[model samples]
Target chain A: MEAIIAVLLILMIAGSIYTLHARDLLSAIVSYGIVGFALVIIFLFLKAPDLAIVQLVVEIITLIIMIAVIRNSSKEDLQERTTVKVEGVHYINLRSALYLLVTGILCIGLFYYFVKSIPGLEPFGVHTTRMATTYIEQGAELTGSANLVTGILFDFRGYDTLGEATILLTAVIGILTILRIKGKKV
Target chain B: MTLFVLCFILFLVGMYGVITRRNMIKIILGLCIMEYSLNLFFVLIGYVKNGVAPIITKGTEQATFVDPLPQAMVLTVIVIGLATTAMLMAIAIRLYRKHNTFDIREINTLKG
Candidate 1:
């Protein structure tokens, strides 16, 4: 099981990386969507179903939004205006080379830092699993819902959900205001 | 272990898009990439070993159930992503109308 998970993780990471570097904006969005989906799978693995559901929904919405943006980004511009021909196939520039080198080093460093090693890391010394189980055992009674995830989200950590909704409202309001500027059709 | 490394790669890709790419559309795409990496990170945070689906099965005692919280939240996040994407698209369209070109290098109207 661990081996399989490790493999999936590797695939996800690779896909995400490729998505970022892909020249096409559409491909990048698609790659990012894949990352969101993978994260949903990961959340399931982590015993956070509520978070996974929310994450998936948000990702889907975001992807759609990005597609809309990409489509309109060049609505009135010449397609040939921003061509980036002759990208690194020739002699590599020193600045670009150095940037890649530093980024590579950082990626490797972080990968090792958080790779499923929970040694003496239990500063709380309490089983997180147990707290969740306890929440599950009592969630229905406390939140009046059978779905423990819903209960946890709306009761145990209801504030987080509230914050999320508030943020969405804020974003929509801001977007509407900006679009409503006089003589502006954005 | 390697999966963690993959996150780094995804992050790096997004960063490259943001820093090296001068096109506004490309920059937005890069930002999306970065946001997506975060979503992936959140999902990975909830995985478990030898876990089975939370479905109730006959003749089953206790089974490991993957957390469903993040999954639920991701759905909402996707919606939020939609709103942001729409706003970005609108802005980009406006910029194009005003500037008449997609090249970031030639955007003199917004120069301070």
Candidate 2:
């Protein structure tokens, strides 16, 4: 199991890096989708079926939305406009390499320093936290939901969910307001 | 443990893309990558060894379950991310229409 997880993590890292450096926008988006799929597998392995389900659906929706946006726009304009040219070379320069080196070193050092303080991985299948125990024991009785995650999302933390819904609605309105054609208000 | 480190590395990679990429769309993709890595880290924090899903079934005895709180929180975060991504893409389209280019280096109308 550990080996499988480690391999998946490695794959995710590779996918992210590939996506970051891919010259084609469409290819980068597809690589990002691959990373998202790997994340779904990780969520399932972590025993969070709810998250896995949500992630699968969300990933597909996000990919479709991004592809639609790309399709609707002038791809040739973007391709020609965004490409960087330095002398005879295109898209590779000294500045990006320096930035990559600096950021890579800084993150490695920061992560190493902080990760030492984190506790080691606990044994699998055993949640030692008190809150988790409490939630499991009393969640059904208190919230009348078969799924504890649903109980927490809708009952225990209903206000937060309400705020989330508001945010979503605001985003939709904002998108419509921004994208509406001029002189034709929706 | 190692998983946390990998997630952090992914975050840094996204940050690198955001800082180095001049294209507006690439920057937005980097932001989405950072959001995803952080969400994965949050969910990993609550994972238990040999834990089952938090769904309760009739006449079934389950010994352990992954923490439901973080799962719920991440769900909210994911939806929020979707909305924000859509908004960002809309803004990107608007910017493209106004400037006729997606390169951030060339869009300098607001420069004082």
Candidate 3:
């Protein structure tokens, strides 16, 4: 099981890297879908059906929104425009190369420190539960729901859900405002 | 152990995208990647070796269930992520409409 999960994680990493570097915006968005779907499978493997369902639906909606934006935006990349065409032969710019080198070094250093800091946390698959033990032990009885996840979400932590709904409402209002045909009166 | 490290690496990959990429849509994609990795990490932390989904169905009353707290939080985060993504997309579309390009480097104007 662990080996399977490791493979999926590697796949997700590769997909994300590809997404960031893909030449075509459409292809990048598609690769991003791959990462999201891999996450859905991983969620299932981790025994979180609730998350899997939510992630799957959200992933699809996100792809639709992104694709719509990409379709309406300029397709040509600035990097492609900057390519130096010397006698019909393209040459890479030195500035982009230098930027890549610097970013790569910084990311590697950050990854190294992150790995070093992982020792402070508990080992995987052995959660301490803390207060969650009660949530699991009596979640159904307290909330009268078959699904413990739903029970805890709507019962034990109902305020958080309320805040989330408010955030969604704000996002909708903000989007409507931003996308208005006219921002100010003439 | 390695899974946790890889999850962080996924996050760094997203950071790389946001920091290095100049396109507005690319930046949004980077943000999405970072969001995903963080959610995955949270769920990963709550995983048990041999656990079932956190549902209290008949005949499985005593089953060891994965922690429900993170799952619940992630569920909300996922929905909120959709909302935020839509909002970001709206802004990006408007920016493209005003500037006629998605490249952030080219869209440099404060005056309407």
Candidate 4:
């Protein structure tokens, strides 16, 4: 399971990088979907079926919306100007390459510190939960649901779910407002 | 530890895209990538070896279950991430309509 998950993570990284460099806007959006669906599989391997379901549905909707928007606009990314032609040979501009090198080094250094700074964390797949023990022990009995994740989502953390719904409502309203034909009548 | 580090690298790739990309859609895609990495990290932290899904059934009443809290939280996070992505996409469409291009450098209006 861990090996499969590691492979999927690598696939997700490759997909994200592809999205960054894709020339066609539609292909970039499709590659973005690849990262999301890869996540759904990882969630399943980790024994979080509820999250997998949610991610699957949400990813489909997001892809649909992105594709709809892309259809009505330009298909080309137009960010391909990063490369300059010098006497028939294309070279990445100096400033962009420099920025990439610096940020790459800094992020790698940060990743090193992240793993080293937290020596107390139980290694992957051997987690010791401080609060989840109660949830697992009595969740089914208290909530009368077979799924503990659902019990916590709707019963234990119902208010947070409500807030999440509210945020979605606000986003829809905001999208409608922004996409309107006119912001203010002249 | 290796899984965690790889997840962090995913995040850095997203940050790099957002910081360096010139297209509006690419920046939004970067934000989406960052969100995915963070959500995966949360789920990874909750996993347990030999643990089954957090669903309680009659036959497996005594079986160990993975942590349920992060799974629940990630459900909410996934929904919220879609909301934000939709919002950003909407804004990007409106900007494209107004400016006639998706290039951020060409959309600038503050230059004198």
DockQ each: 0.34, 0.55, 0.69, 0.72
DockQ for model 3 equals 0.69
TM-score of every candidate: 0.68, 0.86, 0.91, 0.92
Query: Which of the predicted structures, 2 or 4, would earn the higher DockQ when compared with the native?
Result: 4
Q: Per-residue lDDT for A75-95 in model 4, tens only? A: 997764568999999998887
Q: Which numbered prediction scores highest in TM-score against the true structure?
A: 4
Residues B6-99, candidate 3, lDDT per residue (tens digit)? 8988998999888778788888999999999999999999998788898887878987888899989999999999899898888888777776
Rank the models by lDDT, top first. 4, 3, 2, 1
TM-score of candidate 4 relative to the true fold: 0.92
Residue-wise C-alpha lDDT for candidate 1, range A125-171, written one tens digit per residue: 12245456656445556777656556666777778788888878987
Docking class of 1: acceptable
Against the hidden true structure, what lDDT does model 3 obtain? 0.86
The candidate maximizing DockQ is 4
* Model 2: docking quality category: medium
Q: Given the true complex, what DockQ would model 2 score?
A: 0.55
Correct interface contacts retained, every candidate:
0.30, 0.60, 0.83, 0.87
lDDT of 4: 0.87
The runs of at least 3 residues in candidate 4 whose Cα sits more than 4 Å from the true structure, single-residue gaps closed, are: A80-94, A181-186, B109-112
lDDT of 2 at A110: 76
Candidate 2, A84-121: lDDT as tens digits: 68787777556657766787788778777767756665
The better candidate by TM-score, 2 or 3, is 3
